[model samples]
Target: MSFWRAVLAIIFPPLSVLGKGCGSFFIVFLLWICGWVPGVIAALVILNNPER
Candidate 1:
């Protein structure tokens, strides 16, 4: 992942730019940075939830 993308994941804990090209790894990292609940929520939204 890109440096800024990783930084973004750390700060936002699941909120990265859409199609930022970071992928699931970024989501997992974000979860690790934050916690389980936030991580799972982020992953679900990123992986399954549609754009609104």
Candidate 2:
């Protein structure tokens, strides 16, 4: 992930993964609603995926 994306993921997980896909965005958004850490983790995983 890029530096800004990493930072964005930490600050706002769902937004960071917005370009990933609708499914990913929703997943991160839901995880964000549940808790902060999960959302960040999900965003990072999705963003880091080479096959996205």
lDDT of 1 by residue, 1-52 (tens): 4566555644654554445356665766666577856764564455444442
lDDT of 2 at 46: 94
lDDT of 1: 0.56
- Per-residue CA lDDT of candidate 2, range 1-52, in tens? 8999999999999999999889999999999999999999999999999998
Off by over 4 Å in 2: none
Indicate which candidate wins on TM-score. 2
